[model samples]
Target: MNMVNTQVRLAARPVGLPGDGDWTVTEERLPALETGQVLVRTLYVSIDPAMRGWMRGTPSYLPPLGLGDVMRAWTIGMVEDSRNTLFAEGEIVTGMLGVQRYAVTDGRGVTKIDPAEGPVSAHLGVLGVPGLSAYIGMLDIGRPREGETVVVSAAAGAVGNVAGQLARIHGCRVIGVVGGQEKCRHVVEDLGFDAAVDRRTEDVAEALRRHAPQGVDVYFDNVGGEVLDAAVRSLARGGRVVLCGAVSQYNSENGVGGLPGYISLLINRARMEGFLVFDHADRYPEARARLREWVKEGSLKVVEDVVPGRVVDFPRLLLRQFDGGNTGKLLLRVED
Candidate 1:
């Protein structure tokens, strides 16, 4: 088949937030699929805070993208053509398809998704990495008990919102710490969070005191820096803190900001741990089954903030993740 592929390749390592000079968008002729390979036409690409870390040249959980390489991203698309017998033409699939209009893979990381299970978008958000992150990190790590107080930072986001709701389902009192009044209202009203602390309008520490007088039993932290420090001060005895992501310091030229001290852990016998979604990849099937049940039963709600654009517009689109410019999981729709 003859076709042109549009893609954004990393052109430079960004010091802070990624910009235009950081990537080169070009159109090239699509290569023919060989044995065991499949061609995917990207429908949606997930835009995440974790992508910022993947861009830095410094050592991280995953290797950084090399210059002129296709920008890394998780995409949900249709199998346009396939030499792999496992996948059929027109089958919906999800994988690390990168920032491109089309991707060719050997089916190494690809997973077939059933539209009958849910909407295709659900594969990118709820049943995808974000939902898995919330499930394993919160349940396995946080270990919230009935009537315990659970607080989630960046609570209106894709992972954080699901983490909060999962805590509530386990019979815990959930408090969501979001940036604005609208997010606060939506988190509490629309998503069934017990309470929401507006970081932009209210003092987070004071709000925690009012909502969780006894203390925070579990903290699902998405943002570090001051918000983390404030949450630390409210920990109850034997509390657990799940360190999911640190969007607050992703762009800092200096070191990422962190807890003022671990005294809360020492004093309250508390524990704080960092969670990477990939670490629990083996259990994804188990988690996905539960997520599917909840979503189908209408107990779990997934939110997606989709922006309209193509590969050439991805650099500017990434900036939205850094500035709290979008709510829930942000995605760039490469095709209608």
Candidate 2:
């Protein structure tokens, strides 16, 4: 019997927020695996803010997913068959599995995941790039000290949630900037943030003043633009700004620009630095060990909002991340 694979591909470069017309879905027969490759049956698919950037034809840290190409995504899957010595049938793995029901990846590119350690979805989240981003940005770059205050935008998001909690672990007072009151409550009540500012209902800068009276010592920035401007204005002396993602500008037609406030950095003696998660690939194990330990100890929360159904739903599922429909790590459940 021949194996069948369903997939979603990029049909066109999106001009703005991608609509249904931007994608195409098809089913194809799986070909035999070649040497150094393994056939994977996808279980979970990650829908991230970065996907918006991938839909455009432009120069970036990584090349854009071309038109008619399988939509690129990090996925957790089980090995259906293997032609590589490193991978075996029935083993679970995670990597850039694309938006598909089945994928063949060279063993070199994939990472084996043990579900016994944590939820397999986590391999695409806290134990994955988003988690690693939070870890490296906080510990290596921001270097939150005990008794300092840390403020993060997109505080209920995947990276922001972890960043806030990790800052708190270092004995910093942590405040989160979220979109709504419910998300604000989640950040504070569920995630243990000292306070959460609802950007939709509250003045972010004023909220920062109330929550962080001493001014921010560390700013773990996620949404740039106005939020970044507000954060800069509220910074303490010698504050470190750990620049992660700029979801606010991902879908913009014009060039992305934030508040014109370079003078604030000079006045506050603040440092702003941007980083990609892959830069610390060599130290993933170090971060992974600590994150897993935190999860096991109930100190770190691993939240994944999973969208169940077929791979054809990928394009629609991806847009949800931008709309703030997801609370934590957004994932597409490709298989039962």
Candidate 3:
């Protein structure tokens, strides 16, 4: 099989928001598939706030993307050819396929996706990494008890939207903190959260007081920084604060900002825990099965913001996640 490979490569390390010159576009020919390998035609590429960290040459949980390498991304595509017995040709799959028109992998991380069960884009959102993050962050770390209050920042994002809704499912009163009023409305009406605070226009602490009233039991934080500070001030006794992602600090040109004092945690008798979704790999199937069941029963809502263009638009779409331009799981459409 022959196909053109238009790939997005890292040109320079971005200091803050990535510019046009930060990436270089290149083209290559598709390579042949080997035993246990499958050739995939790129369909959609996910844009996550984590990508900003990946571009920097720093020590993180994972190695940073080296200069001139194909920018890493989560992609959903169709198998054009397969030498792997586990996946047949023409099957839809999703994984870290990078930014290119085509990908060839040994099927190590790539998994099959079925649109019949739900929209294919959902495998990248509600049923994918973001969804898993929400499930584990809320239940495993936040541990919202019944009649408790669960507050989430980036409340309309891929992870936060699901996290807030899942908290409600477990009988916790859910309060969402979003960047704008429109997003606040969407979180309350569309996602069915108990209350939605517009962090951009309203004072978060005041809003939290009006919404939660009794103080927050679990803070499922996505956009950290000041939101963390507000949650701390309003946390109830034995409250749990889940540190998921901090879009606010992701692009801080100097460094990650400092949070409020640890003494606050002691005074409140509250605990704050950091979580990476991959840490729950062993339990992904368990989480996915339950989330899938919810989707089938119309209990869970899946939202996706798709930007259409070629592979070159990957960098632009990646920046949107940090800019609050996306409402749900953000993806770049690589093919028509």
The C-alpha stretches of model 2 lying farther than 4 A from their native spots are none
- Ranking of all predicted structures according to lDDT, beginning with the best and ending with the worst: 1, 2, 3
Once model 3 is optimally superposed onto the true structure by TM-score, how far is the C-alpha of residue 277 displaced, in angstroms? 1.1
Clashes in model 1: which pairs?
Answer: none
Cα-lDDT of candidate 3: 0.88
Per-residue lDDT for 169 in model 2? Answer: 83
Better candidate number, 1 or 3, judged by TM-score? 1
Query: All candidates: CA RMSD in angstroms?
Result: 1.2, 1.1, 1.4
In candidate 2, what are the lDDT values of residues 1-336, reduced to their tens digit?
A: 298888899999888899888999988998887788899999998989999998899969888788999999999899999989998899999989799999988876788988787678888889899999999999999999999999989988989999999998889899999999899899999999999898888888888888888889999989888888888889999988989989999999997885786677999988999998887888899999999999999999887788888888888888788988889898888755
lDDT per residue (tens digit) for residues 63-103 in model 1: 87888899999999999999999999999999998999999
- The sequence of per-residue lDDT tens digits that candidate 3 reaches over residues 1-336 is 567788899999987888898999998887777899898889899888888888999868789899999998999999988999998888999999998888889999888898777789888888889999999999899888889999999999999999998998889889999988889889999989989888888898888888877788999988878888888788887888999988899888877767764566898899999989888899799999999998888888888888889888887778788888789888887755
lDDT of each: 0.89, 0.89, 0.88
TM-score of 2: 0.98
- Candidate 3 residue spans exceeding 4 A from truth: none
Minimal lDDT window, size 10, model 2: 255-264
